[model samples]
Target chain A: MSLLEVKDLKVRVDEREILHGLSLSVNPGEVHAIMGPNGSGKSTLSHVIAGKPGYEVTGGQILFRGEDLLEMDPNERAAKGVFLAFQYPVEIPGVTTWNFLHAALNAQRKARGEDEISSPAFLKKVREVAKSLNIPQDMLKRGVNVGFSGGEKKRNEILQMALFEPAVCILDEMDSGLDIDALRIAADGVNALRSPDRAMVVITHYQRLLNYIVPDVVHVMSKGRVVKSGGKELALELEESGYAQFEDAA
Target chain B: MNVVVAKTGTGRALGDAFAVARDRLPGKGAISDLRRQAFEAYERMGLPHRRIEDWKYTDLRALMREVLPLAPQPDATALDRAAGTAKAQAIEGVRRLVLVDGVFAPDLSDLAGLQKGLTIRPLRDVLEAGDALSGQAFTADSSNPMIALNAALATDGVVIEVANGTVLTQPLQIVHIASAAAPGAIVTRSLLRLGRDAVATLVESYLAADGATAYQAHDALVVAIGDDARLDHVRLVEDATGAFNISSATVSLGAHAHFNTFGMTTGAHVSRYQLTVAFAGEGSKVETNGVNLINGKQHADTTLLLDHAVPHCDSREIFRAVVDDRAHSVFQGRIIVRPHAQKTDAKMMTRALLLSDEAEADNKPELEIFADDVTCGHGATTGALDENLLFYMRARGLPEKEAQALLIQAFVGEAIETIASDTLREVAIAAARRWLEARA
Candidate 1:
């Protein structure tokens, strides 16, 4: 059985339909890359699956381990192991990164009836993860994402991803604002978390990031639905030929 | 056509109450004349209504349903109750000066190991001596009637004088505790004087003893910062929901003086803080920050008149309010730069967060700059919590209420973080967190 399944998902935002009959399946230990042009509803799909408000799933069945995912709240979905690396992480002024991370981790643990992580232990885990991501310890002391460079913001998202250790990861435009070195570092962090029991959905517009974190399958998305699914080489083809033919073909 | 101005019932009650208790009031001689003059000022002004620009948002005439008679001085039982409060609210490493029912209680205060160059006296003594400084704050610097009312009815308060060139590491805390059980009003006037080149930290708190319900408070603080002196003042006020308080603060800064202050209020049914600050000498800087966490039909208003009367003076004011559950918050910030006050720098910003649809926030920020070379700017923003931020937090597994508390904390933390003292900042943050927890 697939670890995650989306069957004929249709989503509307503000009375306007964005995703129509989008379907996909992901097994354990797999990485699926969804390539699309701007306004292809990639982010909408990620947000809808994460249970963010304002996205009305008009017609869809999202199953996580055969459980109905749409019925849960965003926090419940998060506690059940779903994480989204935001394209643009919102800056929460006056809230230090360490405090936000600790709260988030403990809240999830509490929701699952597990004991909270002690402050010292949480600090140790954060330091280990932050060190691996080259995130400065001072950044943890500063307000979350406040005054952070674009690269720093993306890396901070990766740090959260590492800390949360979600079973399914959705990387949305992770390479948009990162420099090559920063992108490599972020991709390395993602690679380290790609365990046999974990799955990932990489949503990006360009084929640039697929080079660093190779995808097992690449799906071409146009309008709101996936147009083609093939092996990883499909990304190189699209990169060489550009998305114009796909837009016209659809 | 003939027009007559009628006084409100509350106004009439206050006047009749004053007439009945005038002989029982503190001070005599010249102080007696000052009290009569101040009360006359209050009588002439009547009750502040919406027509008055200063009271536009607060409509004191309508909100003040009735005026309670002055509370009696604390008896033995009252002192025993107040000692526990003073002990509970005590900050470690700080000396406390206690006032029970607006009367100074030395037994509850920490005056055993008095530091050198620091002198503390009850304001009754200064009022009895007819000290010129005691009457300064009640004058025309503020047209608000409450200042005059405080002057006329005040029973007692603390007066702290720091000698010139004296530096004290330990902070001095003045705890104004309303201890009378029956519903009544409390009046106090505290004064802090910093001599030339002196440095100190002052913390004043307004508290109510257990069972003290439906009381009214009229308190004032007059501050004088001398040349090259530095003062960091923190004012924290928390009372029962049935309480009503009107507090005023007037500050004058001398040449190159530095005055940094932070105020937080999370209590009372109707509370107003009228602050008047003036830079009397050049090259002085003042930083004023405040937060108001109001809920459940509470109303909090902060009116600031910051005068940049001298050249090369810099002032910054940041105020925030979080209104929930039909509560209302008001902020009136006015910065004035005189014609010759060139090179003056001033900035004021106020933000309000409305947590419920029924809540209201009024932000009126004005700048009157006559000096051409001065740089001045003011901004006011009233908004609800950012839905995107909430979604972001919830997506990361923080529950709804926790996410909201965190955001509100962050919002108020911007203003709280300006406190220079670690201890005071922690106190402000902890109070804010408790306010959040109660909100949930």
Candidate 2:
């Protein structure tokens, strides 16, 4: 069975169906990139697959490792190794980064029937991971993304993804607000988490991030569903030619 | 016994309702004179009815029908039993001085080996000498009728004196336990004096047992901060749901003194806490922060008046209220900058989060500035929780209930985080948690 599967997913937001019967499947160790213009349901797909409420799935199933991901809560799906790096990471004031990450990690661990990592061990591992991502140590003590710059917030998203190392990680516009330096750092952090047992779905508007991430499959989305799927060259072709052809075809 | 209901010249009831209780008060001399002066002030000012602008939210006459005697002596069994409660145990590490029914409970208190620069004594114990206090006499002025009542009827209260150049690590906890089985009002007057360059934290708690109706408590706290001194005061009010609590705290800050007051209000059917801060010296700073969670049909009023009397003084007041059910919460904060009070920086903000359609919060933030060189502003906002934030959290897979709780916790956490001490922060958070858990 495919490690990550979305079968005929239909997500409606505010009575407007944003994701209409979209289906995709990815094997373990495969990196898939979904690129499209604005309002192309690129972000909706990632959010729906992550079990976000309000986006009703009128007809679909999201399977993670053969388990129905949509049936679980967001945190439960997270415990089931499904993670979505939000396009606009929510700023949780008064909740320290260290505290939030610890809670999230331990929640997943508990779901797997594993003992929580000790504070010292968690700190040590978090420090190492944060250092590798070039995230300053003081940021760990501050409120979660409360006053973070756009670039810093993007790096923080990748930092969290690296820390959790979920089986099916979806990065929705993780490269949207980042500079070249921050983009490289974020991509590198994501690349470091790429393992044989894990899969990733990168959602973005531009194909520039595909240069470093090097996805195995590239899908072009327009009007709530994937219109075309191809190899990594598809991203380059779409970047050079734009979504003009897809828009006209639809 | 008829509960004299004579209408006075000002459309208020003026009678000898408290005369018998006043005559029954023990002790004599200057302390008695203080009580008489307070009684006279009460006779003139009387119990604040709806006419008084400050007491508009909590009409005293409507709740307290007649004069109630001040409760004398602590119920050893009751205090002993409450000692085992969860909230009592939370203050184990604090230097506690317990007062039951307005009378000090020495047996239940731990005053041994008190901080080097600190002294805790009862009001009667130090009432022998007029010069015992370095500051002005504890007289009840017309500015506060409740203070007048408390001064007239106060049996006992905690007196704190912090010596110069000393910083106390632990907070001095004053627990005022009200078991108003008696038919009289309970009045408590506390005076806090912080010397030059001294630092201290004072935590006060007002708790009442069940079945104590027609209860009237007039509590007053007068804090005089010396030059360069720092004081942090936290007051937690958890009275009986039927009790009527009207309390006032007047804080006077000297040059370079820093004063911070954080209050948590939850109980009492009609309760009001008035805070008046005067920057009497240059470069003084005053910060007042409070949060009130009123549920059921409870009415809570938190009013503050900050007077920047001197130049180069800064004052900040932040008050928030969360009203649920049919409860009502009122926050009236006024910051006044006097003429020639140059370089005065003052800010006041009150935000209310209404949890139900029937619940209401009245926020009145006013700034009166007469000085050109001062910066003062006041703002108030009352609304329900953000629907967008709730939806966002729910979209993240959190149940709607969990999402609402998270958003609310975050909203109130802003006020809780302003607490300087970690222990106090935890205590406040725990109080908020208890409030949420009861409803959830």
Candidate 3:
């Protein structure tokens, strides 16, 4: 059985339908990539899955480990081991990254009836993870994404995902605005977290990120529905063909 | 002889009970005359209430409808002992000087460890009862009724003098403890003088032990700081229930001198703290920051007046209030730059957070600039906590109540962060946190 199953998921933004009967399923240990052109509803699918407010879910049935996912709030979904790397992350002032991540991780832990991570243990873990990702300790001390560069913001999102170690991770155009070095680091961070019991859905418009973090299955989404599905070679083919064929279908 | 004093709201019956005992005006004939004139000014104005635009949010007229009686002459020794170490423990690392019921408690205070050139004594003891600095800077006889009343009843006030070129490390604490044997009114006064190139820290606290229908008043003055002098002043009030508090401070700054003040009010059924400053020398700066955390049906009002009299002066004001239950919070701030005070930079900001639907917050920020070359602006904002931020925090696993408490503390912490003294900053932060814990 798939770790996350989405059947006939429909999403609307501002009373306008964005995702119409989109369906996909990811079993544990599998990395699925959703490649699409602009306005193909890739980011919308991620936000709808995360339960962000103002996104109307007209019709959808999302199951995580055989449990209903739409019934849970965004944070509850997060606590249930679902993480979404936002396409455009928010800047929260006066809330340091260390503090924010500490709260987020402990909150998830407490939700699962687990003991809170102590400050010392948490700080050690953060330092280790941040060091590996080349993120400075001072950056963690600063307000979350308040003054971070585009690449830094995306990298921080990946760092949070690694820290939380979610069961199902969604990267919504996580490679956008990232330089070559940052993209490599972000891809490495995501790849390091992949396990037999975890699933991931990477949504992107380009095939560059796929070269670093190769996906087992690649699907073409047009008009909120997956129109085509193939193996890893399909991404390279699309890159060479440029998405003009999918644009006509959309 | 039954003297019938005219009653206000609570009536002369209570007024006779709270009338101040033992009026000790200084023998400086000229100074006494000026005091009388100031008192007359207050009489003419007569306790500004909601009718006055500046005092609109603070209804002193409604609060003073009934006058409480005053206690008879105090027992100097008992009052002196009560003002000492017991009071210093409330706030740590403080050099204490206690004023009991508006009278200086000499035996209970400390003058040791004071750096060279700094003098701490009673205001009456300076220059055979009059200091040159107090004569000039502290001599404002405004049309403000509250200032006039404080001047008329001024008796025992501290005289703090910072010698030229000396910077004291610890804060010099002046504690004003008002004790009423009966339900009556009491007034207290204090002064500070920072000499050229001198630096010091001053903390003034007003507290009232269990009392019945008490009224307390305070009038304070701070003189010019010479070029390169630094002074940090903090005023706090914790009064009893059914008590009325009116406190005022007027400060003047000299060339290149800096004055920073922080005020926190947690008590007093109806408390008003008035802060006014005038910049006299060039390149002088002043920043006034205050936080008022009120609960129950308490009423807290903070009013400020900044006067730019000279050129090249900068002034900033940041005040925040948290009102819960049926409590009401008021902030009225005004910045005035005179015609000759060109190149004056001033900003005034006031924000209030209401925790309940019934709680109300009134804020007024004003700026009157005469110089076209200066940059002056004022803003006032009153709103409840952002629902999105609250939801975000709650989604992080903090209980709903705990998340709200954290947000409230962060909002007020912005103002408290301006306090330059780290120890004092910690004290202020802890105090604000305690307020949040109890109320939020």
- Using lDDT as the measure, the top candidate is 1
Sliding window of 10 residues with minimal summed lDDT for model 1 chain B: B134-143
How displaced is residue B41 in candidate 1, in Å?
Answer: 1.8
How would the candidate models be sorted by DockQ, starting from the highest? 1, 3, 2
Instruction: Please report how far candidate 2 places residue A130 from its true position, in Å.
Output: 1.4
For model 1, residues B209-238, the per-residue Cα lDDT tens digits are: 899878888899999999999999898889
The candidate that wins on TM-score is 1
In model 1, how large is the Cα lDDT of residue A18? 90
Query: Each candidate: what lDDT?
Result: 0.90, 0.79, 0.78
**How is the predicted docking of candidate 2 categorized under the CAPRI scheme?**
incorrect
Query: Global lDDT for candidate 2?
Result: 0.79
Candidate 2, residue A226: Cα displacement in angstroms equals: 2.0
**Better structure of 2 and 3 per DockQ:** 3
Q: Using Cα atoms with residue i matched to residue i, what is each candidate's TM-score against the true structure? A: 0.95, 0.86, 0.82
B12-68 per-residue lDDT for model 2 (tens digits): 322354565666553466667767776776766666777888777767767554545
Cα RMSD, each candidate: 2.3, 4.3, 5.0
Task: Sum up the clashes in candidate 2.
Answer: 4
Q: lDDT of model 2 at residue B51?
A: 88
